[model samples]
Target chain A: MSFPKRIIKEAERIVSDPVPGIIAKPHEDNLRFFDVIIDGPEGSPFEGGHFKLELFLPEEYPMMAPKVRFLTKVYHPNIDKVGRICLDVLKNNWSPALQIRTVLLSIQSLLESPNPDDPLANDVAEAWKEDSSKAIATAKEWTNKYAK
Target chain B: MDSDISTGFTTDQSFDAFEDDGYDDLDTNSVVSVVAEEPLSYEVPYTSLSHEQLKQRFVSSVNQIQNLCGLSHEVAELLLIHNKFNIEWLGERYLDNPARTLQSIGLDLKYADYSFAPRLLPAPPNFLCAICCDDATYPVTFALPCGHRYCASCFKTYLRMRVSEGDIRLNCCLNSECRFPITDSVYKLLLSPSDYNRYRDQLIKLYVNCLPYLKWCIYPDCTYAVECKVNQADLDHIIPTVECNDGHKFCFGCSNEEHAPCICRLFAKWNKKCADDSETANWINVHTKGCPKCQATIEKNGGCNHMLCRKCGHEWCWVCSGPWSEHGTAYYNCSRYDEKSGQEARDQQAKSKASLERYLHYYNRYANHLESARLDKKLYLRTQKKMTDLQNSTSMTWIEVQYLANASDVLQHCRRTLMWTYAFAFYLERNNNTHIFENNQQDLELAVEKLSEMFERNTSELATKRLELLDMTSYVSTRRSLLLKDTQLGLLEGRWKYNLSN
Candidate 1:
């Protein structure tokens, strides 16, 4: 049940100097699993939205990437309904040098630029590619209704 | 061999190079050049080497490549692997563009300064590994040529994880942005002797599997490779039979046990048929005759013609299966045709009996020839002993009596071909071509039996008898080859003219 020295330091660093719009904290019961909240970047359709995420460090930890998933509702092509985000660094492009701070920042930036090409939500991606204004309007309305 | 052609294959090997260059385009040219400019003195398809010899070859090649290229053994291995262990190809590529070739295999020759041997990195005052986030100022640190530094423990953990996953073939630095791969020197420095040995073994296997010319000896736990002279393209129309150093013979084309004269496809199909339980089903239909009185199937295990049905307690003759009372009265009219039986019963009985007879005819021959071949293998030992005896008793030297060994080889080859012919005959129907094939097979069978008899009657007249044995061996070999050629032609030309009506 003892956490690695690296994980403890990362948790301490994140608490002392948290990112401006992102919040990530390990649960008291489980040090490996962290509860995260990301505020959508400004000027995007999901500007005011609050998105929740869950991140867990597996046994292999730095050698392997963390298991990350969205826990809150968001209207975006890259983020599926079940909250799986299609980010490169989270999968095959992962490097042991990357820490939790960098990962959360990547997710926060992913909200700003929803890569419709590498979309997890096919229907959302189609709508966005076909008509951007309409998709953005739907995204803003959903953010207001559910993520407010 | 209709035509002989050879060209230096520098350009033809570009597809493999293109893959190394990370190009998506597939080079689809089928240009395979077999260099037979200087014909080999005597081409023996297989030469078995011991396991120690095989390892020596590997280590020596690794050392030679490492020295010639001024690179580490691991980098030379990657180059050799990329070139399919064709040392000449790797040399050409290396000579053409040394740095580019090294880079292609993920080695940065510029950074790897072989002029100065690598030394342990001096522990900086407060250097923390990004992975563990520990201030490993006191612990040993490994700084790769790529300038990425990590604590000794962290690097060891990462390497162990990769090695265990069988993903150590091309492991890279732990830096998020660094593109440099972890070299063999690092592994040798970090790992214990046992773990390093495991790593080396995996690396060797990776190199071995990439080469098309090399194949592992199929014998269980034997670590020898059968290196063929012909490349994959040359094997498109030819079946290469290879013998391992362990005396295990196999068809290199299909990696199956050696089956000559029969094409690889047919041999695989025939082997599948023999291994399955379908033969038992065929035996049931052919061997067990149902009782006429009770209709209960009966398998007569003994040579007795009288079969008594246990279910009905009715005894009858096996051939016609008539009542025991009818068979006992003087002349045994049970063998005679009886028109009183129902037409349906008579037809069914005739059909089963005919099919069973056909099956028995083929199976018996196949089983007999197979047994003969097995026995001949033991005879080979005796043949060796006899050859020594003849050499000692007569005024002849060992070289003069080498005909005995040659005869033994031809006899064994003929027996093997005869054994497969019976398998070939089983699937074939009674057609004109099949009849011709059967005639050829019979010709071989007679020659083989005659040779077997001659070999059995070992006479004291060594000189004349040895010549006779040599002639008989050649005669049997020719007959076997003719039968094999006929069967091979039929298989290749799709001459399956078996009548469905039968």
Candidate 2:
């Protein structure tokens, strides 16, 4: 298990009753660790392709946030190609009041509503922001070529 | 709202100053008025007297009489009752010796009653919390003749807990002001059936009924306050049942003036703020619903998401208006100077029209996006709470952790160099002060290229990490639950307990 008991516990409930665009399953050996999938929100450039995600609990557990990274190579305003996130909970703004379940749901929301205004991958964000159609096309093409 | 006879006498508030004056002795025939009417305001002269002589006349002491009767204790009193001359000249002429004088009048009056001296009467005893005073704690009760209040459990405990725990002597616990304990005689006054019943009623109304409870503001700020619930009865003017030192009072209804501000109006104002913020965001859609370049609000707009900004004379895709302009046969007027050729002036007007449309489109979406984002943030916080709670009961664990070492480092390196990239966008996107790339053209290009390369390389790797994180979160709870249960069972089944002995 790569996750704390607290995070793994919440993930179980979410998986059993998955949200509309969110899906998940355990990684290889560690029950604590797991792989998740998210279909881009409808009306988004990432639509139709299944995007992958990685999640696990840290040693500090509930007091800290879980580690979440994107697995799909698709371009997004918030996520860099390397799958790193620019979410608030993952950085300086993390509060002890947050947990894994809230964090993942927040990430799912990020996909549905990417903030190109605060870009993580500047070029992809630029492409997305300046010419959304081209960005959407690139996102869809990447989804087909890699996510499948 | 029944009979609105607000005479202020209803509670602590009095109707007017006409009250509490000499209303009790309205008729002048009473002897009590002789003294009460003219209070000697301590400015009168005094004849020196030996303390011994004054004590002999009082039978107790002159000092006691001076202190109790509101006479200045520092001055020696002159005994003038022996031979009174003028009405105002003799202090003793008014001072009647109740035992001797009232007896000669054939009125059977006890000195204790007639003298108006401060006598230790068997005051009605009551009980309350020793700790919180008026708020009685059970078990430590004591009572008075009024039988109004008694710390029943605590009184007994006071007797028992006395020797070792705290102060041995226990006093009355009604209000902090009442400190006399109930003696045997005082207890009887409490035993009086009618008085005891009356006391209990008073206790409930005075203390129990006016107690504090949970209260929170309904405003967006949602500040919480703690005060007696009865105080909120006139919610519009949150007049506390009791006033504090500083004369600040509030009306609960409007959270304003003590009694006047209308809460209904305040609520309406609060509602308007909420409504205004919402429509403001929605309004943006009307202004910039389409792509600035091609005027495509949704995908079904036209030939492609490509278009040219003929007004500003900038060219780009209609879908997003990216900086890289596509070469096209588009032409428009440019109005750049105060004095220019006729052809140039015409170009300016045409170009202005096109730029204006693009600007309006971009502006609308930009504004709309912000309002929606604010609303979304609010909703997210609310929903996030529910999901976090769900994780606890379901099968979630916070044991394992996955690293984004490779991916984060790549993004981090790119972040260090984005300043120049933004400069390029700034320069390309604006005409004057907002130009970033123009200020550092060469550096902007290099930074953009470098950052783009890092992003392109990291995309696939980051994708894997994102998937890993998602999957870990998905089933982590179920797996955690089983493990936790197993560990608990193992401990109960002589594993941890058995090992502890060693």
TM-scores for candidates 1 onward, in order:
0.58, 0.23
Q: Write the per-residue lDDT of candidate 1 for residues B268-358, one digit (tens) a residue.
A: 6667766787666656766687888888988888766767789998887776656667656534345544635434555676776787677
- Model 1 share of native interface contacts: 0.93
Q: Which residue runs does candidate 1 get wrong by more than 4 Å? A: A14-25, A35-54, A68-94, A101-148, B1-44, B49-75, B81-99, B105-109, B112-116, B135-137, B233-237, B268-419, B422-436, B443-502
Who wins the DockQ comparison? 1
Per-residue lDDT of candidate 2, residues B221-273 (tens digit): 42223233333343332222221112122333344422211122333343343
Residue B430 shift from truth in candidate 1, angstroms: 8.5
The model with the greatest lDDT is 1
Model 2 off-target regions past 4 Å?
Answer: A1-5, A27-29, B1-502
Quality of candidate 1's docking, in CAPRI categories? Answer: medium
Q: What is the Cα-based lDDT of residue B8 in candidate 2?
A: 16
Ten contiguous residues minimizing lDDT sum, candidate 2 chain B: B7-16
Q: Model 1: iRMSD?
A: 1.2
